[model samples]
Each structure stands twice: as structure tokens, then as C-alpha cells.
Target: MTNRKPPLLILLGPTASGKTKLSVEIAKANRCEIISGDSMQVYRGMDVGTAKIKPEEMEGVPHHLLDIVDPDTPFSAADFQTIGKRLIDEIAARGKLPFIVGGTGLYIEALIYGYEFSEGGADPEFRKEQEAYFLEFGEQALHDRLREIDPASAERLHPRDSRRIIRALEVAHLTGVPLSEQLAKQTKESPYEVILIGLTLERNLLYKRIEERIDTMLANGLVEEVQILLDRGYSPSLVSMQGLGYKEIVPYLQGYSSYDEAVYLLKRNTRRFAKRQLSWFRHMKEIQWVDVTDSSNFSAHLSAINAIIAGKFA
Candidate 1:
């Protein structure tokens, strides 16, 4: 009984670090199924911007929790925690490994720790007011405010992520406690024995990859993807539309900003986002960093992951 480890695996890396393909390959070879931990990827009709994996890319390995909500519907970290925990149980019961994959640090943290969000109850009217304020003074102003109160949370989140920034600010304002401190107070009560595998690369190469991916997304119709979302009556102010790609394109689509300007901002913001993601993961002590600096070491990385699984659960 002591040797029987709880089954849960995590494949984490920044955007454009090649998590999807590596996760699928590992799942295919090891009879594992993937559970997406991405906050934005849960929305429908927002594919290109979120870099969603097509069915073909999944290669027959079952995936869960992607495209499960509309752009307007609010999906919280608690919702993700509930869905992800259930999927892990169901997949393990069915004799497949449950691999939680994505770069969203808070969502992943929710799965690996116990925390109560009850203190941060929403004031819809106040949130709307904050949203309007954000538009007026700009995202940088909002981020600076958050940085003053909850520097840790601000560091982990992108400046343009108004929804989270608002929430963090709200928590601090209402509770008289910083959002980061509240999360820190939680007792770690993770149910599964999580083997967190982090994919890493040289900084220069990683930035290059992020830039190239932004270019690829634009070429692959990311702007058109936002056009469809707007055409469907999803507001530009919706939490989902405020995502990296969608938000950058909204100005260009509305003729307020030039296409080149939007593209430049997208690439710059994406690089910043990736840096925040890396900063977040680096703080977590459990992650086993694997350098995939060269593509040739991919097989070696897989072997390293397999060895960890074997050592823990075999």
C-alpha cells in the first residue's frame, strides 16, 4: 500500500514552449489523458488566439475541459479546480494517467493546493465600475495599482489581464489583506501525488519562439477568430476577449489602431506574458526542470519523466 502512489502528472511551460505536442506524445505512449488547465482555452470559438489543439493534434488521446464555456460566462479558479479534480479521478479510475497541462499558474496551483475563495465575493456593480476605470486610465495604470498592493500577484499576471487584476485588487480592497497573502495562508491539501514536469529553454530562444508563435497565430487567422467572437455578440469587454491575442486585435478590428501596431503589441505583450509565467513556475519548489533547449533531448526528457513515474508509482 505504501508503494501505491496517487496518479497525477503535470506538463507545464510558457506559451509556445511546445507543451501540447509533448504532452500528447507522452499521453499516447503512456495511456494518459490530458486535462487542460488553461483559463482562456475553455472558451468556445476562441481557438486561434488560445492556440487550442485541433482534434488531429490530440492524436486520439482523450482531452478534457477545453472549450467548455462561452466567452461571456465567467469561469473562476474554483470552477477549474472542481472540473480538474473530477477529471483526474475519472481518468485514473478508467486506467489512464491524468496529465494536467498548461501555463496558467493559478489554475494549476488550485489543483495542487487547498484554498478557499469565499472571502473574495464579487460586487458586480463594483467590477463594472473597475472595468470602466481600467479602460479610461489604461491597463498599465491598473497594473501599477495592483503592484502597489499585491506585488506577487501582479508579477505573475499580465498587465492587460484586467479581470484578474480587478479581482486581485478587489480582494485587497475588501478584505484588507493582499491577495497573495491570502493564498499563502492556505494549507496544502493536494489529493494526488503530482509529478510536475517543467519544460524550459534558454531565455533568448524562448523569446524567439514566443515571437514566432505570435506571427503564426496572425497568419493562421487569429484576427478573424476575434471577428467571429465579436460578430457573435461577445463584448470586447468580456473577460475572455481581454486575453492576449483577442484584446490586441480588437483595436485593429474596430479601426482604432493599425494592423501593424496591433501585431507589434501582441508580440511584445506575449513575450511579457511568457516571462511572467516563467517567474511563477520558478517559485514553485516541486517542479523538476527539464531543458529542452535542443530538440534532440526530447526523448531524453521523456525518459526522465518516465523514470520519475516509475520511481513513484511503479
Candidate 2:
């Protein structure tokens, strides 16, 4: 039987893996309109920290879903799925290839696989109670609560990640199923003619890139950008603030950690986050992995990616 599903190209990898640059090249060549798969790039005024693509850097290719929300708004995988599907259809309707590009695994997974998140799974009161508990007892206690209900989730989440911890607990509380288990049971079926491409680098080289990216962010006013968000009355406790670059810098701005310490933590945490991203992608099925370690040969990499897309979509 011939599959007539809409074609969707996905370019994903860890932070600083050159997904942004490569996606742009491929998009321009392939008549593709790029929809950001990044969870953080959606936030307004968070450019430097998220490594958001600059206007001039876009090179005339249309990009969607960047700077769409305020810093205080909560954006979940379900939200990404809803908006992403709509954008993909819209782009496809306009006779452009729909390209999803970024490293946020959960959001990408939910969108492509059409993960169903039950409305009954959410309880505002339960969330409020967990937030109160986190405020009163600290993040470790909250994480400990998640550990009892969803050990796998706890194992993955850091103790300081109170928001995710609370979310895991809430999923268990309202749905009577651990968040990890629910995720594990998702039907990994896509409605689209999906092409999943992953960019990877050698571990040491990837870490070097991550560290260099952090340094570039710092040089480009990352601290000031974070301070501006704080000045706008966005609380550090907000989930958006807990993101990679923002979270590490908040402590320095608040005098909780020295600038050097904050930078050190940012580099270390970003490296760890990249490792987790690679781990998540490794577990996903059907990714055409490309080793982009030798970035000196840009044309070769672009050709390799285009060849992969042509094979799948032709």
C-alpha cells in the first residue's frame, strides 16, 4: 500500500551540535519551513541563553514558533504537540516542506508520536499543593516524594528540578500511573511520513562545543539578558527560569553564587544536559544518525543530510 501521509522532516540533536546551522542550509535547499522543536526558544527575551537564531542568521528562510510566549507562561510537551501539529499542517498547506528542528526530545516525541495526555491527568489544586510543599520543605523533599511514586522519573530528574518532580507526582496522583510508565506505554506511531535525523559528535568534542557555546553566550550579554527578565518580575521559581542557561545565571545575579561559580555550573550543567539529550535520542527509533564531528567539511555534511531526506521523501 502506498503511504500518502504528509512528509515531515525532523532534525534533532544535543545542544551546540550545529543543528541550527545545518537545518537552515537544508531548509533553504529543500523548500522547507522550519518549526522550532526547542522548548526554550519559544520564550520571548530569552535569546542569548537559548542560543536562539538571530534574524540576520535566518538567511531568509521562514522559521516558526520562536519567541511566541512570555517567560512566565508554562509550556509543556502537550502544548508543543498542539501548536506544532497546527504549524506543520499550515506549512504543508502552503506547499512547503514542514521541518521540525531542535533538541528537545520530549516535545518532539509527543508531537511525532501523537502522545495522548488525558485532561483528567491534570489537577491545579494538586499542583498548588506540591508547589507549597516545595516552598516549605525544599526541592529534595519534593523530589523524594516523586521518588516514592516514580523512581525512574526521579532517577532522571535532578533534586533541584522541583517543577518536573512535582509534575511527575501530579501525574501519579491524578492518573494513578507513574509519569515514566505512562511515557513508556505511548504508541510510537506517527501520522506523518516522518524523517528523523540526528546530529552527533564525539563526546570530548561535543563537550568542547558546549563549553564554547556557554562562553559565547556569556560574552554576548547572557547575564544581562537574564537580569532583564528578572527585572521584568519573572520569578526565578518559574519553570522557564529553570531552563539551562537561565537557571545557572539566576544564582549569580542574586548573589547566591559567584560569577565564576555560575559560569562553571552553567558549562557543567549544559554538558550533562547534552548527555541526557543524546541518551534520549539514542532510545528513540528510526533516527538516521550523522556524525557531525568534523565540521570543517560543511558541504559534505549538508550533502549527507540532503541525501538522507531525498531517500525518504522522494
Candidate 3:
């Protein structure tokens, strides 16, 4: 750890793990401002789908990087790396703790590890050909091409994630460096003194939570929210529209899947996504896990976390 590095408090967990409320409580108590690490939350029109905290819900704790771009605009982990690190520095300079709170493992890792994208050998022509391939077939086809070249990254990415799939193929084609190798090749040094906190619940409990969260979203005008975005001229194929809650609801709104069917699929897929999130965090050894299942209350959990922070920053 760098002796002079600013403190970074991270609160991470799978979807519906109550990370947002817990993070807010901790941040409010500790004079910390949160920098969201979510990919979908950056889009301007996305709210319920991204599980975004409303302004009144923020409880006066400042947040960064939410509602940053339009649905059609492309944002990547590289963007998060740049913007997130800058917020960490800016927050610390203002004499407040910086809290990075989200379930996006790649975004968090990129910020913490200072990941360098070696674009030294990038070939725009080759990248254009890849983009043409994506347009001809689909983003899944693009990811399939990557699977042949870089299986490590392919496993981590969703099939519709064209931006990362293209970048991986570009790296392999130009420099013979797969995206996995580029990240793994770097020395494992975190720039900030991160007080990492990972929240978890029982598996069955978490699945139940996922189902209930979907139910709440539906009741709270999630379908209407998607309609508003479509009404605003965003296409269904836009990357932001393909987010978990947004994409599943599209079929229903387009006169395809019934509302019940869309709701069912959303719940099922979200459970699977939560499982993948836990898998991602499991591999990141730095996060100290706390089973909210075992805790009596959230206050107790925060108290325990404060002890951990004390040891790190004492």
C-alpha cells in the first residue's frame, strides 16, 4: 500500500444484496461520498432497471458517475477506470472518504489496479472489419470470435457486450496479447488503500430477494419507465437498453412476450446474474466478506466494518 494514498471504501455485492442502502448508511456515517461502479447506471434515462438511488434517497451523501450518457453512447470499463480514479482523488482531496459501491467487478478492478490498455499496436482497419462482422451477424457472433481467441475474457463477458469483445479481438490480432493476459500481466498493486467490504446473503435468501426485487420494480412502474425510454427514441438494440431489467421488459412492450412471461424471465436471469457476480467476487481475494445473513442488523454490520477501517487507517 502506498503510505500516502487516500483511503477507498468499497461496498460490493450481487444485485438485491442491499448494497445500496448499506453503502449509504456507511457513507453518511463516515463522511464518505459514493462513486458508482455500475455500467447501466451511467446512462441518463435508466433508473429502475439500474436500481438507481433517487435524489431523495441519497440522504445528502454525494454520488458520482450516474446518468452520465445516452443509451446509444458506448461506455467501457476503460471509461470507468479513468472517471472513477479521478473521483477517488478529488474526493480525498476534499477531505472526505471515497466509497466505490457496485457489483461491477471489472470496473472496480480497473480502477484499483490502474489497468493499462496497450493500444500501441491498435489497428483501426482491423477493428473496423471486426465492427462490420458485428453488424453483419450480431454481438454474440463477435463474442464467439473472441471465444476462439481469448476464452478467459469471453467467459466473463455477456454475449451482447460488443465493445469489450471487439477490444479483446483487437488486442489479440494486433499485439498477440489477449485482454486477459494484459490484465493478468500487470503487477498486482492497488493504487489506493482500499478498505474492501463485500456483503453476502444465503443463496436461497438471495434468490428470494431477487424475485421480490423484480416484483417491486414491476409494481413501481418499471414497465412504464422502459416505455418512456423508447418514447424518447432509444432503440431496443442499444447497449443500455439491453441491461437486465430493461432488455427483458422490451419483449413485453413490443407486443411479443406477455407481461407475466417478461417478469418471469427477468427474475430468472437476475438470479443467474447474481450467481455470476458472486463468482467474480470470489476470485477477487482482497474483498473481506461479511455474511449479512449471520448478522443481527445492518447497524451491527456497519460497526464491524468500522473496526476494519480503523485497523487499515489507524
Q: For this target, which candidate reaches the highest TM-score against the unseen true structure?
A: 2
Worst 10 residues of 1 by lDDT: 305-314
Question: Top model by lDDT, which number?
Answer: 2
Clashing residue pairs in all predictions, respectively, total: 0, 0, 0
Q: Estimate each model's TM-score.
A: 0.93, 0.95, 0.92
Candidate 3, pairs of clashing residues? none
Candidate 3 lDDT for residue 16: 91
TM-score for model 3? 0.92
Per-residue lDDT tens digits of candidate 1, residues 1-314? 47555678898999888899788888876789999989989999989999999999988999999989999999989999988878888998998889999999888998778567786687788778788889899999999989998999898777877888998888887889998999888766677788888989998989898888888898999988999989999999888998999989999999999999999999889888898899888878889888888867788877776776665655
Model 3 over residues 98-173: C-alpha lDDT tens digits? 9999999888888888888555567889989999999999878888899998988888777776766787788888
* Model 1 steric clash pairs: none
lDDT of 3 at 85: 81
- How does model 2 fare in lDDT? 0.90
The lDDT for every candidate, in the order shown, is 0.87, 0.90, 0.86
> Model 2, 1-314: lDDT tens per residue?
87599999999999999998999999998999999999999999999999999999999999999999999998888899999999999999999999999998889999999998882457899899999998899988998888888987886776777877877888889878898898889998789989999998899999999999999999999999999999999999888899999998999999999999999999999988898888788889799999899989889999999998886776
lDDT minimum window of 10 residues, candidate 2: 117-126
For candidate 1, the C-alpha RMSD (Å) to the true structure equals 2.0
